[model samples]
Target chain A: MVSLELKRVVVTGLGAITPLGNNVSQYWQNLLQGCSGVGPITLFDASQHNCQIAAEVKGFDPSDYLERKEAKRMDRFAQFAVCASLQAIADAGLEINEFNAERIGAIIGTGIGGLKVLEDQQEVYLTRGSDRVSPFFIPMMIGNMAAGLTAIHTGARGPNSCTVTACAAGANAVGEAFRLIRHGYAEAMICGGTEATITPLCVAGFAAARALSTRNHEPTRASRPFASDRDGFVMGEGAGILVLEELEHAQRRQAHVYAEIVGYGMTCDAYHMTTPIPGGKGATRAMELALKDAGLFPNQVSYINAHGTSTLANDVAETLAVKQALGIHAEKVAISATKSMTGHLLGGSGGIEAIATAMAVATDRIPPTINLEDPDPACDLDYVPQLCRRQQVDVALSNSFGFGGHNVTLAFKKLKG
Target chain B: MNKQEVLEKVKTIVAEQLGVAPERVTPEANFANDLGADSLDTVELVMAMEEAFKVEIPDDEAEKIVMVQQAVDYISQVAN
Candidate 1:
């Protein structure tokens, strides 16, 4: 067998602390049940703001997971990444002494890393003095701290980097991790995304840009992806991570395999910074190239975890992209936007959604796109609305489109015997 | 430390820290259940109490001091 065939990448573990739930089991359960995590903004006062709803991780306690000093040193985003990575590492059943340090890597992504730190430090500078700003400001604010801290804790000496392509970051990190194993760059990699940008500044910025929903009266129902009345995305926070291992390495170690990473495609919209191209041209190419990378035809794709952000534009553009890439098979494919339930976690969306896709492949269950009532005619597809469906999902595609026209798609498949 | 004085100070601090009304800070109120303090808030509150009174609170000790009275007594004993 060729090295590509011999050294396939597989997902050995999954972890997430999402708006919908605090862990993988809870998140997956809520996802299948179509439960909405969106609600009135609790992190800050939204009384004076246009957008008053967001999806916040309900019971997060960073100090519970990290030391007090460490927790103080890191901002919310880094804390989320560390927490999710801890779960992933434990789930993988990896022994610290089992593998060479150089053969293991860590890659975590953040769309807007440490926005909370930015806000806090700016406040300190304004209210107090520049000298009063915490000495850990820069370290806490940098996007790479998540991966760097993970590496420091676990002694993962291989390639470590943070992807910051806005929303596509999660998919980009996972895809890059898969390639690390494929190219023999690393035997195993811990990869995913974390984001905690549901702050006053972030919400105000999105609202100022007219990118967030103002459905304050009905917070739970505010995030209605693919619906005709959809207005804009609901800001969310949390982290999701996966343990990727080389097929041979996992087999030799008798590790559990959840699913296989079969394909990854990334492209640029080249159209706009904040808006996707007029018909999802970049998104279509991303999915097409992803299918090609998976060596699967359109018919082989059973489900799609759409990046349906509950915004008017993303839903239409993503629906058309699927149609363009998958042809007639797009109609047959069951499309579900887990974001409809979990809201958009920015960079963390792709990691958890990838886990959702792999779980759908592993468990033969497809999560539903909640709040799909009154769907727009433009986004007409089998959105797996209302309830979970038990269907044999051999392969699933997860799409993530970010700002700056970055588009990414990843393919996962059931592990073959 | 006068118990009433300690209780009043504790109530004020808990109310301010947890974002609740001072009258809501009763001896029977649970930090998480009645006072609306999440795990993080509780931890920070304990730290603040320690700094205010110049005392150390172990995690086990902090967990035991859930109510306003308990926290005030614990602080008074350690501080005195």
Candidate 2:
């Protein structure tokens, strides 16, 4: 076994443009209140689609975060990423001057980048001519533009890249950022995931795959994770970004530390593309690895932000994974599926969920899994049902499982001193 | 369109495409040096101008039209 010497990394700032709320404070407040962001799809005409409801970032005007021309040139995902990055930079109060500019980096993840832009450009190409397609189409539609634009916006001339691991992309990005800082690759990193795929093709494709909830009549209660009646995930669109800095660097700058990221573990099932292995072997190993990396036992984990996507297979498999990984301690951990309220933000889910986990570690409050009216027997874990729970939490784990059998678990611990 | 009409149209297109106020879009303003436009933004501005004027500016000529007045002159010469 290779002994690794890593620097300490801490999260100093959090930003979220989520369905629950626009910023971190509002998102956290709404999560504690168990608010649901799902509603009838107003982005486009979803009347014919089976899953018509979604958790869209309502009332988001790109002009609010960017100039009219800049907003026009970018896809919604990149817009959210830039907006969230700005918010996080401001919250961290770290001035990027000539001295430290090159030491800062950015890494953003997206499952599907600029799908809406692609769809619209394709339509323009078909109806008009190829030349009629906006010259901004290619840049706006590429997934890496979020990180590229974010670096340009923040003036961070350091490492810049994007991760595209389906739903696990966000967590993977954050985990990679943590490693970068911990390994002395950079002093600080802006990392997260952004996704805005609520387009005609995305909706139609998910509907065809039967991966979305069809509870069109009651939109608010659509994403019922770990519940017997849960049908499927409700699509959500947003971005979540965090400013991760080396502990000494953050301390030198006198930044406010939200929580210390202790460990990160990533594994692939290699079993299926869209489904987990029956026993969640890959997920269990990821959780075990994260705990080992953190130097903590299973009983030390007080809360879990589960990747309970409301799919029948995932919920049960995740429960089994947790049980296998934590044994009897699984019963004591307060696990909640925030997707029950925010719906599934796809790649954005891990970033936002990690924020939620950090906040839980900082504030000792666990958000509820709203709409879990009847628990599924196979998923027989304490899912911190419909009401928020207030309990002192020292260690928290956030899990994200993506398509292509990617599993990531991030462990965050409360600041000791 | 006449010179004055073309200038006005060019100003409007540049103002809208660059997210700058009409007053800021002076005839002497260089798109890259003055208006904070990157290469991609310049390309987009050219595309928007092409769509507005209904004239296809060749890539070689588009590269030459850097300033607002330059775009106006190119559009006026080609559009007719």
Candidate 3:
């Protein structure tokens, strides 16, 4: 018979390769400073595309983390996942020796995996014959390769899996990993999300959907979340990985706990394909469920890393969702739209936002929502705009909603000990 | 291509594909054993050799190329 008692989970390590910066320290520093990572698309010539601005991960050299042979075998997304996972594992100092190798696991998520590979290989297949196509094409383009490659690089032999729930994938991965540790499935999990879909096809596809900002001249100010003039989200790329350990396991290993992950809530609109349900009811329910799961009152939430995608729909809907979930305290809460600085990282957003929330909980500082010079009347919540806010953040929530109306909220609390 | 010319080109490909130094990719070096070319790596290496030499290496003939020298010999014999 399984024990009814649930184990406490804590975030022992964090790693990120984000648009604002590569590592967690750099990213967090830049975020607090309200640095804008958006620029003219350099990965590809955007002269012909309708949407030209993107928040591409700058100055990331795969050789810094992986050998040439191994890096060459994986796609850019998988490379980011492996590098972030390695960084988090090192930060945790949780050695995967012969005794504990089988007790750890991995779960990495992605929105669209390796579009560059698919586009490149498709060209090869069309111009040359099928035989000329690369043998690594399939493995490199698939979404699950991130989890698979992370596991292979980290030697995590327990339960290995991947979540492909669009933007909510990263949150789902983290939540499921938390579940594994909360129950008796695994002692630790290297879990999060990675995305590198700033390719021509992705840009064109998003442009066709009118889901991207077309502010080519002013790239830095393009992703103006909760702003009245906000057009749409600017495409961004990166990865975030966290090492979640059981409370007892972390105590035994003497791992430094950043914060405690107390709750996760997932919901689907079942209403639309891309647009969120009216008033973001699904998101409201998700936030409510997360608070309920954590056994915390709405007034207890101090900071919220809002899924502020800068699109009119997301900003307005997310604002309403917060109001509905938290009622009067929603106005008092310090909400942040870090997407203004990092841009929307798609699947990677949830992972990095969770890190941001945990950082707020641990450090008592909230990063600002840059470029929010004019707030939309509909989104009149305290959106810690213009500058970072130094406040007492005891409990924080990170929200991530995906293309499939997938809503996920993760609750994090400051470790009192 | 001459046998010596093919050997140089093959050595360069092997070195690049296997992520090893040129000195490590000797003519007698086995792709898998010495150069650490896994099964998939060996396939890609053969594809690269086939493209460079302008020759189609049949699957059966490709399987026999266990060493670097074998690739050079096959390309040298097949290339116009």
The candidate that wins on DockQ is 3
What is the interface root-mean-square deviation of candidate 3?
0.7
Candidate 1: give the clashing pairs: none
lDDT of each: 0.87, 0.92, 0.92
Identify the superior model by lDDT, candidate 1 or candidate 2. 2
Q: Residues A33-65, candidate 1: write the lDDT tens digits.
A: 888898988888888888888999999887667
What DockQ does candidate 3 have relative to the true complex? 0.87
What's each prediction's TM-score? Answer: 0.83, 0.96, 0.99
RMSD of each: 8.6, 2.0, 1.0
User: How well does candidate 2 match the true structure in TM-score terms?
Assistant: 0.96
CA error at residue A181 for candidate 2, angstroms? 1.5
True contacts kept of each: 0.00, 0.82, 0.82
Model 3 over residues A1-417: C-alpha lDDT tens digits? 123688899999999999988899999999999999999999999899999999999999889999999999988889888998999999999889778878899988898888899999999999998998888999898999998888788888988988998989999999999888888789999999889999999999999999999999999999999999999999999999999998999999789999999999999999999999988999999999999989999999999999999998999999999999999999899999999999888888888888998889889999999998889999999999999999999899999999999999999998766
CAPRI-wise, candidate 3 is high
- What does the lDDT read for residue A275 in candidate 2? 84
How is the predicted docking of candidate 2 categorized under the CAPRI scheme?
Answer: medium
Docking tier of model 1: it is incorrect
TM-score of chain B of 1: 0.90
Rank candidates, DockQ, best first. Answer: 3, 2, 1
**Candidate 1, residue A19: CA error in Å?**
1.0
